[model samples]
Target: MKGVLRFGKVVKLSPRYIGPFEIVERIGKVAYILALPATYIVHNVFHVSSLRKFISKDPSKIITEDVNLQSDLTYVEELDRILEFSVKQLKSRDIPFVKVL
Candidate 1:
């Protein structure tokens, strides 16, 4: 589902999709009732635009990486290694820089 409700949290930090929940029933042409978890303190009925079709998961196509995110949804990026180092010749001084991966 599209992340519309923030639930008092930061909207940008919240997940885009909460679940691929089972559809309980169709309310009308553009609304549906989902079988949401008991922990979710919100209405079960949602507009069709807010819902997305669940595609079957493919293990071979999945890519996983170890990422440690902070409380504000930020992560510290560490440089693997410096690829190249160069010094630019200026009129009075030389500026040094390094290219990293």
Candidate 2:
């Protein structure tokens, strides 16, 4: 899942559970069939160890936004605005950090 998640410059943070896809049925004692998005070209069936049941606490928190995926399964996050810019002095150099809003 190296290219599974990408957030701006941060690309090493990979999620344990990718989605809360609907379970179509049980394939076997250790396997299950899931209804994944069409954007995913991988197999829908997965092992039970790789699945996690999702329970929504707030129904209004449902995500209805569309995710624009590239051919390589990468999505670009648009930067709204730069809130603040600062520089931190390290041992031998200054590191610049920008806060975006």
TM-score of each: 0.48, 0.65
Question: 1-101 in candidate 2: lDDT tens per residue?
Answer: 44333312234453345555678899769999887778665577788876777779996676645455566555666899999999999999999999997
Cα deviation at 35, candidate 2, in Å, is 1.2
Candidate 2 minimal-lDDT segment of 10 residues: 2-11
Model 1 residue runs over 4 Å out of place are 1-10, 57-101
User: Which tens-of-lDDT digit does each residue in 1-101 have in candidate 1?
Assistant: 35444333445565545546779999879999988655556678888887788776774554434345454434466899999999999999999999999
Query: What's the lDDT for all of these models?
Result: 0.68, 0.68
Q: Which stretches of candidate 2 lie over 4 Å from their true place?
A: 1-11, 58-61
- Candidate 2 steric clashes: 0
lDDT of 1: 0.68
